[model samples]
Target: ANTAVKVSIDPAQDGPVINRHIFGQFAEHLGRGVYEGVWVGPDSTIPNTRGIRKDVVGALKALKVPNVRWPGGCFADEYHWRDGIGKPEDRRSRINASWAGRPEPNSFGTHEFFDFIQQIGADAFISANVGSGTVQEAADWLEYLTAQDSSLAKERAANGHPKPYEVAFWGIGNEVWGCGGPFTAEEYVTKLKQFSNFSTNHNKNMPTQQVAVGPDGDGFPEYAEVVMNAWSKRTWAWNIEALSLHRYTRNGWPPNIPATGFNQKQYASVIKETLGMNDFIKTNIAIMDKYDPEKKVGILVDEWGTWYAPTKGTDPGYLEQENSQRDAIIAALNFNIFARHADRVRGANIAQMINVLQAMILTDKEKMVLTPTYHAFRMYVPFQNAVRLKTNYDQGVYKEGDINLPKIDVISARDNQGRIWVAVTNIDPKQSIDVDLSLLGKSIASADGEILKAPTIDAVNSFAKPDVVSPKNLSLKAINGQLKFTIAPQSVSVISVKSQ
Candidate 1:
């Protein structure tokens, strides 16, 4: 058994409202995430809304996904908007070597993305190409997406929709540091300055936010400074709404490969790897504050979550990893991280949404099942519109072999409507943590919670039984003003406190 950690809450130092955008998801044209996952086209027998899967849309909708970043990771830079829009047959077919190395027929393009976003009720944040793409193409896309009653609007009408799809957020390029092209900070900034020149339509009063790939968050502050410096000339806020930061929970392919078939020890290692995202977001936000003092720009974790090896015999580019209880811990921890730092970190869209890396929903032909990570995202729905309250984690320690690592036990909440919520995770896989909970702001409270725990961290649900490792409701009445709670090692526990 591990010792209990105490968490204190203070309302004075409140952070930004956890943007529903922080809970946003990513959908790329790569792998099954787009083709088999989101788009099966209109000809399939499976029920779909004009080619996009209706079941998948309905599943993600229940999760309250606030925004969806589209087109690509590396594919964003290679994506030619011309190849995607207009009549289906009119769209071009190109060899996409970056993601899957297959010939991608632009069957599912910009209009399709907007249609899907509309169906899901999610804001669209499209990533523009800077590699193998141009300023004119980027400009034309912005016009096509945002223009209402002009030549661009006429083009949009000719394709299909007459109404404009207001894409509030935009990413200049993905990983301009690496796959976005190995350019120096100075080199990339020059490119960004040029891209910005074309992406803007000040004459039309078209409001759009452009995000730039930052300083290295493989973990460092230097690269962020280099990328944002080019925009110092903009006195009335950056043309970019969010500065993009792409960091995954783990580095290797099929991260669960080693832990997949192992026991508690390997499970502990895999779960611990998920906790490192806490450091990734915190350190990067600190860098952003130093450079842009007022924080007019937001830290957009556009691409995140675990990048692990594929399931055995699966296509590698598809990034089909086993989504287990450990993945749930990763979701809870990262969501809370975003909640804690909501002030500067406004938007976060996990890498690939479905049937790809760290996906929330997985499917096999028509046999679809939500992963544990999906439930965590759904459970976190309360924190979206909730006020960011000050949380004091009486830090605890989790031991892995000889290493004694400090662990954050709980995140507290005090919503705008006077409701208090605390979401806790015991990332330590070895033993349970008994916490002596207390409240600070207002006295006399009644509470309840739902906890998701399992025997091992790597446990997951297949099509056979989808109930494995899901959250179960718990009693959080805080017996006589004290809440005695035990968060199972390697699991997530959420508590809601209401004042009496």
Candidate 2:
């Protein structure tokens, strides 16, 4: 038997409130992500509310999704808001130059998105088109959504609803270093400031939280420095409240990595990349701390998650891929990384929330299936809104090829009900590890939990086998003030213990 890994958690010591927004999701206008997977058209045979799938809505609500970003990633920078408004029939059709070059029908636009968000009880975080749009266009879109009274408000009312949509978060652009625009950080900062100035809060009751397009994962420090430096020198505060960052966990850049049926080497490589996010957050936050010592602006990892080659015959533009138990461990590690840094990591939306890369749910016509990543999210819900608790653990190492990773990853939290929750992932592909639990603040009176695993690491769920990888009840017992349990290899486990 391998030595038991030890874990210690302190409930009395509190840190940042793991903001609900940090558990946010992203739904871009890519492939079936918005069209069939989310909006199935009102007249379709599927049961839907305003063209949004009822099953999809129910699943997202169960996850307690706090927010959903809309419109685009690279697509957002090129999207023209006007084309998606007024009438669905009258709305213009355009080529999605960013993804798969598919013709965008503009059927599910701003109104439809809000309808979906409302049904799911999530907030909207809209990304503006800065690469191919004007400041006036950006400002007018906000006016149309948030203005209580005005000609644009009248135009919005003419479309359908008379009330303005309450929008709190707005992204100035996406990936200013690449698809967003070709401007240097200096030039982009000028544009970001200009765009923020006009994105006014017509609804005084709901103030807007403006987010500037930040650097990509590789472009940090240098890109972040230039923008933060500009903001520091300004005589007044920039409207920007958050700086965005995008990263993807993959074996290589793009189009080479496999989505499923990978060997242990490939899996380890991906795990190595996912684990690197911890350093990414630290270094980026270090730069943000340099300029804004008080952390006035947040670090929004708006685009993140596993990205792999498209499924064999599917359009590469659609970014559709099969998710496996491997992806569940990936999701678990990344979410824990975000929670560990909850203080500055204000919000994150995993890339393409449905029927796309690393999606939570996949839908074919009227049929919907929850992926392992979805179950991982469901299991980790207790981490949301709870205060972070410092956890110290002796981590075992898993090695493959040239990569070596900590065999275990974890995050701990204490909810308002005084229940202590610990989420743990054992990433070792071959061996289950015994864990010795130490609860710091109080003794564990009782413990119960669920574990998500499968017979094989590559095990995945489909419409024919939806329950192939769902969570199962985990057994645990508190022995002499210490709770003990065995974690399966490549599995995600969440344990909630009530302490007196």
Candidate 3:
């Protein structure tokens, strides 16, 4: 029997406004993620603007990408900004030790990154190198990007960009407990104070919020406890406005899970694992609330997404994985979770932007194809800055062996333009679920949006067949203030409702 779920949304009981930055992306200097996936140089045959791919910028703009974190996951710790600045031919070269020891040509540097984000109409979230760098180095880098009349600013002008760039968020360091520094929570807090103190914003109009490294999911609550405790006692001289947390959905490290050709058991395991993100957020937030009762600090899940073993023949260090419908569902689930905790959950960036992990766009030289995860991000654009409406639903169970999941997941919000948007995901892989929505304080006249559903759970889009998994138009009419719709199994749908 098909499951019947009832979702009650009260627009009158408006909650926190979901931050648009929650839809941010991360672009690292790893694998083809930056080299071929996003940059191909002006001399290449691919259509590019100042060495940045045009197709990628166009596709990301459609999603209204709020921000992009650059200079990487582990790469930031080893990257020397000075090496990536000057003339391309004169630039220094180093081995990407974090990745597959590939030659780091320093081709795509700071100027190129700002240009790419400008083209996509997104803000910049840069991660500083504290593991292998000094406070002076991090401070100088900021002056170079945000300083107006300083020598670094003149240096920036000598390169190309005469004006200072606006950096929205500055991550102190990434994964300080691991690849970043392997520093103890106490040791890292000391470094955080020194780095945050000197990393000043020269562009007073655009102040950059500092993000301190936090825990690695629920496993290390001590990291959050210590970081927040330190933040709680921080003086006006040195403080952080946000804390960073990193989490990824995967079977295990040295990933044994494959991105394709998985069976029902594997699929169920992945869904069950991905759903744990809710608990991860709740656990960490609880700790934050204890130390900072006023909620002055926000949590940024900077590195997240599905992590499967690299596709066959791909470099293991590259961390490249194929994205499927399963990935799309995971993306929707995380978005819904983020919306529920919008007050403290200010932003999040999927593991990588292109051709890495669960990416939005995959590029092969000149050809590019949008992934299912890309469609999911496009569909959820309506919820970017919308105010969250109080939603209640009786979530039934969908069981596969020992793995149990909620049959249906949902989130509804009222956009700035007064349109009510509802996102629903049917988690069951075999049976479709029926949703009956009752909206309070709003009489729905009609509803329409896009639905992303593929023939199978593992369905994906390839260069040869890009449309294999894409969103299709969906329409529904409300009767007596109640909207009815049937959501296909293992699919995500976003509906825009207009009041009568």
Candidate 4:
């Protein structure tokens, strides 16, 4: 029997305006993620502007990417900003020990990344190196990018970017518990203060917002306890505005489960695990509340998405995988969870933007293709900067291999343009779910929808068939203030309503 989920939404009752920054992206200096994924030097056959691929720039622009975190995951912790500036030919090449031990040409340095960010009109969220780099190095890097009058300004002009860049978000460090520094919570808290103290705002135009490394969801790491507790003790001097959290649904390490070719049991396991982010956010928020009582610090899930084993013959450090409809469902579920907790959740960056774990776009040489995840993001774009509406739904279960998941996941919001949009995801790969939407006390004259779905759970858009899972127009009508629709199995649907 097809499960039925009921959603009741009240437009008058609104929550926080969903932060547009939550739709942020990450670009790490790993594998082709940097070199071929986004950059393909100016002289190359691939159409590029000053080395960055134009096609990728155009696509990311369409998504209206809010902010981009550059030069890392673990890569930022080990990177030295100086190596990426100056002449591309003169830039030094270093071994990327953090990712697949590949050689980083340093061709795509600070200038190139900022150029790409400018091309797409996205804000910059930089992750500074703290584990191995010195305080002066981190401080100088900030000065070089944001300072108005400094030797660094002349240095920037020497490097080709004459004007000072505006960088508002600064990540103090990344993954301090693991790849970052292996520091104890107490140890990291002290270092966090020390490093943040030096990260000054040179450009008064854009004041920087410092983000401290929080914890990995595994065991809900104790770093949060020590850092938050310490902040409570010394609130006056605390400079951190956010805490970063990273979580991935890899099922198991090393022998990670397959990305595309998988059975429902494997899919169910991944879905169940991805759903665990809700608890992770809640647990961390409780800790944040206890320490700050006022919610002064925001939570940024900076590194997230489904990380699977590399495609068969690929380099292990590349961290590449194929995205499928399952990934689309997972993305929708995660976004919905974030929207529900918009107050404390300020921003999130999908593990990567291209050619990496659960990426939105995939590029081969000059050819680029949008993945199912891309369409999922396109469908949910209206939720950005929109006022989250108060919603309640009667949940139904989607059972597979002893694991039962709530059949329907949803987020409702009213955009600044005076439009109401509802994003709904039916995660069941086998059965379609009928949704009965009641816009309480709010009248709607008509409704239109776009849905991304496929025939099977593992259905994907290959180079040969890029549009296999793109969003399609769906005909919908609101009858007597109620909208009834059937969301396809393993699908994400976005519906927009015009009021009476």
Task: Give residue 354's error in model 3 in angstroms.
Answer: 0.5
Question: For model 4, where is the 10-residue window of minimal lDDT?
Answer: 230-239
Work out the TM-score per prediction: 0.93, 0.97, 0.98, 0.98
Write model 2 residue lDDT over 5-103, tens digit each, in one string: 989998778989888788889999898899899988989899998788999999999899988988879899889988888777899999999988889
Q: How many residue pairs clash in each candidate at the backbone level? A: 11, 0, 0, 1
- Model 4, 105-186: lDDT tens per residue? 8989999989999999998999999889888999999999987778998999887887899996999889878888978889
Question: lDDT values of the candidates?
Answer: 0.77, 0.87, 0.91, 0.88
State the RMSD for candidate 4: 1.3
For candidate 2, the lDDT comes to 0.87
Error of 2 at 424 (Å): 0.8
Please state the error at residue 221 of candidate 2 in Å: 4.6
- Report lDDT (Cα) of residue 314, candidate 3: 86
Model 3 score (lDDT) = 0.91
Model 3 regions lying over 4 Å from their true place: none
lDDT of 3 by residue, 356-394 (tens): 888999999899999999999999999999999988998
